[model samples]
Target: MKPWLVVAWKEIFESLRDRRTLLTSLIIAPLLGPVLFSGMMQFTLAKENKDHEQRVEAGVLGADHAPQLLLWLQAQGLKRVPAPATESLVTAAVRNSQPKIVLVIPADYGEQLSAGKPASVKLYVDTSDSDARRAGERLQRLLAGYAAQTAALRLMARGIDPSIIQPVVTDEIDVSTPASRAQALLGVLSYFLLLSTLVGGMYLAIDATAGERERGSLEPLLALPVSRDALVAGKLLATMVFAAASLLLTLVTFIVALRFVPLESIGMSANLGPLVALQLWLSLLPFVPLAAALLTLIASFARSFREAQSWMTGVLLIPTLPIMLAVVAGLKPTSALMAIPSLSQHFLVSRLLRDEAIPLPEMLLSVGGTLTLAALLSALVVALWRHEKLLG
Candidate 1:
């Protein structure tokens, strides 16, 4: 057998024997995405369903003053409850009563409307309460609708066209399909998918380099006939294998979990079938070698297994930073941006999730750029292994 292959086989065998490493890398890491996504979707769907079924109870402080408005609210299916005497009481009612919103109409509300003057209606709600916030928004829209109708009627009586009062007609048309729209909800899944690659090979990289050195085996192994470059290559190859396996497992788990999620209820669809999973796996392939080489390089500098783990924890954050920035800034993918390694893979995965066709040139640029960087890093790792401090 080739020297590098022999070393890689030894590393893989040792890693598989460690129960802790296998539990974290093979089992927990792969299962994390599916479990997390499923739990979040279930919670969100349950909350939305509960909200839809329950009727909004509105407390009306001066119901007698605005009979017409009360009728309009009733027509919109809002359940009316008798409100308290004062504004302070209305605030208390929102917190204590079943009513999520309290509508306070002034004593002169009817008089002002009859005289064609503006009548003030105040909504008292606990903004901290999500249910109250939603109820308040609905009440605001209902009031606006009533105001517009009244204004149109008044304009008609004055022999003026109501359309003349509005100079512009604005229409907003959404171009996103259900799958594209669902990307917002499933954005975190991309981060986790990319993260699996970094995490899966981390333990093996640390164990092969720092752990072996700490156990006093590295010096004896280095004295062998195999070249330093081959040893590094062997470890790099092992790390890449683990990373690739982790990514593949995560993609498969996501495909299965997505099928059971009630995404259709939220007007979103995730078609992560076998073909999509295959495409995602292909797009992520180059990243495995890149992540492995980078991690192995860092782990090589550590003096002990625990030190390597500490360094890797900080290094793993590097790949996740781009994903965080993309989420916060709502980054759109461009050809130039595809040259960046982790960022490129993230954009490709997002495009796949949205069911958008990736341009051939951009795809080539991402894969080529990542592979080139991986080769450069691997050379650096080889050079580092030749240095005298590598033993210290």
Candidate 2:
């Protein structure tokens, strides 16, 4: 066997023998994302279903002033509750969460309606609260519907055509497919996959370098006849094996876990069938070497296993930063963006999830950019291994 192959086999064998390494690489790292995602989706779906079934209750400060309007609101599933007499009290009640929202009808509201003028009704809600905001939005929609109906009736009573009041009407058309709609919620899958890939290789990377040094085994291994290049190659390759395994398992686990998620309830469906998974795996394959090289490079600098773990924990967040920034900036996949490493993988994975065809040039740029960086980092790792201070 070649020198690098011998070293790689030895490292791989030892990692398999260690229970901690096996547990992390085979189980925890791979399952973490799927389990969390499943639980979150389940909870969110349950809450949304519950919210839909329950009637919205809003406090009314001057219910007597708008009896007809109150009846209309009640018919629309809004339960009217007794509210405070003053606006200040109603605002305080909403802020205190006694009621999520309040509808205040002014004394002249009926008079304004009788005179054919716009009658303003105040809706008090705390915008900072999500539930309150959602409730407020529902109330606004109901109010708008009521206003439109009332306006049309008034036009008919005046012997005028109601449709003439509105010259333009719009029919909304949604062009998004089920898979594309799901991508809006599942875009974070790329971040999870990238993180898992790095994590799977992290223990092995640290074990081969900082761990061995701390255990006093690295010095003996360094004294061998094999060149430093071969030793670094073997270790990096071993790390890549675990990282690749992790990446694959994470994707597979997500596929299985999503099966129980009832995504159809939200009108979204994942396009992660076996063929798509294969495509996704291939597109992400280039990232394995980059993750391995990056982890090994960082671990090689640590003086102890604990120190390496601490450093690599922070290193894991590095890949996520680009994905976060891309989401925040709402960036589209451009040829220039494909030149970025982690960000490129994110875009590619997202495109696959959206059932969109990736341009050949973008694919090439992503693969080329990732592999080039991996090669540079691997060279740097070899240089670090050759240094005398590496023993520390």
Candidate 3:
């Protein structure tokens, strides 16, 4: 066997024997993202379904003041609840009580309608609570619908076409495919994938460099006849292997978990079946070496295993910053942007999720850029290994 192969096998053997490393690489790191993603999706879908099916209950301050309007509201699906005695009391109740939303019909509401004037009403709601906010929005929609209906009836009474009140109307057209729509919900997937991939190699990186140094094993290993470059290559190769396994497991778990997510409820359909998963896996493969090199380099620079773990943990989140920025800016992929490491993979995975084709040039740029950076970082790790201070 080659010197690098021996070192690689040795590192792999040690990692496999380390139960904590194995657990993280095989189980925790891979499954954590998918489990959390599925839980969030399930909760969001359930809440949306509940919101659509549940009736809105509105407290009316002066139900007697607007019997006709109250009836209209009731007919439109609002269940009127007993309101507090006064508007002040209603506001106070809404601020701190059972009913989260309240409607105050002034004493002149009916008189204003009779006198052909615009009637004003107060709506008290606790906006701090999500459920209350949704309920208040629904009540606002109900009120708006009633007003429109009343306006149309009044226009008809005057022998005028109700459409005359509207000069321009809008019909929103959604051009997104089901798969593309799923990208909205799966926006954070790339972050999770990259993070998990890096995490899979984290313990091994620490073990190879900081842990070995702390155990007084690194000095003896450095004294060996093998070239420092070969040692670095062997260690990074092992890290990449574990990272790749973790990436594959994370991808598979996400695909399986999404099957139960009810994404269709939100007009989304995750295109993460076997075929797409394969495509996504390939698109993200170049990132594995880069992640391994990055993790190993960070760990190699740390003074102790605990310090390496802490530093690597914080450094892992660095790649996610680009993904977050891309999402916030609604950035579209361009050839120039493809030169970025994790950002490029994010763009590629996003395209795959949208069922779009990955341009050949962009794919080359992503792979080339990632591998180039990995090579540079690997050289740095080799140099670090060759340093006399590396024993510390």
Candidate 4:
């Protein structure tokens, strides 16, 4: 048998024996991808459907001034409850049960409106609550219309044209594509995929390098007739296979989870088909070598598995830099940006997600560049393995 196969089979058997790693690699990681995606879909669907609600459960502190208006609002799906004695009580109830909106109406609301001397009423709303905020906006529109009708009625009694008082109008049009509309939401998914891929492989990479070194097996393995290059190649191949497998598992689960969702609710055109999702998996393939080779090389440099684990944990964090930038700046996937490790996957996956055809040339460039980097790193690992201090 080839030494590399022997190494691979040995490592695989050892890894299989460690039930925790086996469970994490095969079951936990796979399930996590679906659970993560499904959770996000549920949250988004809940948020989007909240607006189509039949009624807005509102609490008012100063309904006395607009009792009639409040009654009218109730007729229009706006149910008002009297405010509780304390805000904390309201918040606690809101946290536990059905939706609640606490509206604090300032004192002296009716007197100022009746006086007609620049009367102003203050309304306190929970901006953090989407339901509350939507209710607030709807209520504001209702009040504005009420005020306008009231003004017109008063003016008509005096025989004045209220139309002249409000001649201008404001209008808005939304021309955003569904994909572009979901940019922030999609950007979040990109971050998650990056995280799932990078952190997912950290354990395997740490084990392949540091674990081997610590187990006293690395020195004897190096003493065999097999070249250091072959050994490094075998190990690098093993780690890449592990990372790629985990990444592929997550991508598949996430796609399956998305299938249960109504994509239109989140401003996406539709759920991805098997082909498009498969494309996304292929797009992330390049990152396999990038992540594994990078992490394995870095971990191999460490003296101990724990030490390597510590260092790679921080290295695993480096992707957040580009991810956050992509989120805030709304990055476009241009050709020049394809070589940036995790960022490359982010760009390509997002593009492939929408079923957009990635140019062949650009795809080759990314794949080629990543493979070259992987080769260079594997060569470096071999060099390290050849060293007395580093390997022994």
lDDT value for model 2: 0.90
TM-score of 2: 0.94
lDDT of 3 at 143: 84
- Clash pairs, candidate 3, are none
Q: Which stretches of candidate 4 lie over 4 Å from their true place?
A: 52-57, 84-119, 126-135, 152-166, 177-183, 262-270, 360-365
Ranked candidates (TM-score, high to low): 2, 3, 1, 4
TM-score of each predicted structure versus truth: 0.89, 0.94, 0.94, 0.82
Better of 1 and 2 by TM-score: 2
Q: For residue 142, what is the lDDT in candidate 1? A: 82
Q: Is candidate 3 or candidate 4 better by TM-score?
A: 3
lDDT of 4 by residue, 1-392 (tens): 88787766666666768777667765676677568767786787687777766576767766666676667777777776656765456666555433356555456666666676544544456667766677778777766777787788778988999897888977888787776555445555665665566555666667777888898877877788898767766666676676667777777777777777777765576445677667777877777777777887898888788898689768867877876776578777666667666677677767665556788866876787677776787677778877777674
The C-alpha local distance difference test score for the whole of candidate 4 amounts to: 0.70
State residue 256's C-alpha deviation in candidate 1, in Å.
1.1
- CA lDDT of every candidate: 0.86, 0.90, 0.88, 0.70
Q: Poorest 10 consecutive residues of model 1 by lDDT?
A: 48-57
Scored by lDDT, the top model is 2
lDDT of 2 by residue, 175-220 (tens): 9887887787788888888989998999999999999999999988
